[model samples]
Target: MELVSLNATHPDHGGKSFQKAASVVLHLLVIAALTYQIRGVARLPAHPHIDARILVPYAPGHTAVVHPPKPKIIRPKEEPKLAMKEPPPPPPPSSGGDPTGDADVELAMASFFPDPKPDLAALPHGTRGDIVIDIVIDQDGKVVDTQVDQGLGHGVDEAVLAVLQTWTFYPATKSGKPVPSKQRLLFHFERA
Candidate 1:
């Protein structure tokens, strides 16, 4: 036969609560101690007798002082004061040589019709005449402009004009620089 005893209040429950609180506090203290121990190991050496002369401040009178003579900005010497005067006249050139004859523009080479005669069928059958073209030779020895000074009927003028467009010339020169020079070119076409 067994008898059962039941009580609502138990002292063991309070004791277990106290033990749980103490265990938590002890665990926290241990963790804190380990953290501080690691931080101490990682810190830099705290040397007590280190020489600090490099960090010392300079004494008041120890700097080298140089007092230079009052600096005078030297200025350029002024030109002798001149009363406003007219410039001197240039010397006259000698009259012995031809001034206009300084450079002669002989067409060192003039562009000409590669073929003076074209297919007769291509041209209208008629009296062909001569056409004089005026050309302006520009710098760089290139023919820049051309105009038909004389026009001939029978397709002669257009043929001459077309030929002139392809022509080149040695440009006129003045002071060794190419200057535009006017030249006259004649294209003669005679019907046989």
Candidate 2:
């Protein structure tokens, strides 16, 4: 018999050639892939299945009704009203505080005692001192007796006494009876 070539010759024009070893490798990969596919299909279960789940809402068949109580009526009590009295007007600002030393005495506008020193022509303005005078008043509210307890210079004592003579006080009373009362008078003399 004539010698026949067993090698499969690959066509080549400066191209790659598939050797015998490379062709054997490709055939082995294709057979492995087909065999794995067939084995995977055979391992599956005989019947196909689908999972199912159900949800339902709750319903109340019966419920009792509730009613609120009615509100009660309230009435205010009758009260007798008394007549309102208006308070006396506030005292003038010129007068000094609590001069008579008696809170209950109603001196009104005619009250004595200066917050500032009174003017004295004999002495210079801004002369600072006080002249105390003991005043004795009869039941008639007239200055009956006068005595100087202390004196500030420049005849201020005489000037204060002169003013005291003209003053008419509310005669002091004890237990509703007019009584002779003596009160100390302070004459404050300050500069200007």
Candidate 3:
């Protein structure tokens, strides 16, 4: 058998000129795309100039001086004083005289007891009443016992009793000698 040429430019079959032209065109297109991309990357955006003096190394005798911020001082403002009226003086004690008919024994006065305002929040608004309590004062001028003869409820009675227990009284005197005595106290509670 004769040797047959397998060259791409053979005349028995159509030459591959179309393929060669297409390859040349493809190569040209790739070169064009690469050049376009490189040209776009070569351009740089405008930016502000930065001073690099702080990055410089300091010399032996020339040192950089840095100052710390000063501290702030603050002062408090004064509050205004309010004008309020003083409470009225307590009433004098009743002169019911001693039950044993001891003329020398003086009864306890209303002023001797402290005037602690009861917590009226438990009671209705504008509620007012009297709470009578009988207290025994020892010869040492301390309340030894207390009995609620009358009470204005809503926890007011307990509050009053607790405050009275801490009070120190002036003991009664019989023939100029200190003696334990029993006295009745009247506390009037009025809501303000």
Candidate 4:
């Protein structure tokens, strides 16, 4: 015959007394609960009877009646009588010649020049710069586009462009007729 001992060197092997105490306390609690429940049941009276029935709510004697809406009657509209006014007399033939009258005239070439120097304001004191821009002229001899070709930094360039916009441009002509053209213009600005 061989004997087997359950004790081991590991720490988990201890606490046998604590485990036994916890088990005893739990068993006592369960037994006490069962005894208390049984005593309450003994105190109750013998046989009780109960009855079940279906219930319904009370309703009113009167109910609502829905009615359809009446159709609308449309009245006819009367036509308005327009008074005939004599057509206004044809206007006299215009003295101003029509622009398309001389279609054969070829465009005449002309150089662009500013009638007067552009006004520059708000320039920084003692600032000096030159701005070069390509100006586009329309057939009516007006500056259409003032694209900056070479610009001076700071607000000087903006001032120059603003002034150039107000200046009149001489439109290039071909065969004596005004035509659109692009020309390079330089404005030297100096603040004294």
TM-score of every candidate: 0.39, 0.38, 0.44, 0.35
Model 1 spans with C-alpha error above 4 angstroms: 1-108, 111-113, 116-128
Clash pairs for candidate 2? 125-191, 125-192, 126-191, 126-192, 127-191
For candidate 4, the per-residue lDDT at 172 reads 54
lDDT of 2 at 12: 75
Pick the TM-score winner: 3
Q: Report clash pairs, candidate 3.
A: none
TM-score: which is higher, 2 or 4?
A: 2
For candidate 2, the TM-score is 0.38
Kindly report the root-mean-square deviation of model 4 from the true structure over all alpha carbons: 25.3
For model 1, residues 132-152, the per-residue Cα lDDT tens digits are 888777765566788987866
Q: Write down the TM-score for model 1.
A: 0.39
Q: Write the per-residue lDDT of candidate 3 for residues 32-127, one digit (tens) a residue.
A: 664432211121223335322222333456654443335566755976778999999997665445767656666543335667677799888888
Instruction: Give the per-residue lDDT digits (tens) of candidate 4, residues 68-117.
Output: 33556676697678899999999676433336663334432344434334
- Estimate the TM-score for candidate 3: 0.44
lDDT of 2 by residue, 90-161 (tens): 975542224545343323122453243335777776677878888888887888899988888676777678
Who is ahead in TM-score, 1 or 4? 1
Better of 2 and 4 by lDDT: 2
Residue 166 miss distance in model 4 (angstroms): 1.6
Candidate 4 lDDT score at position 72: 63
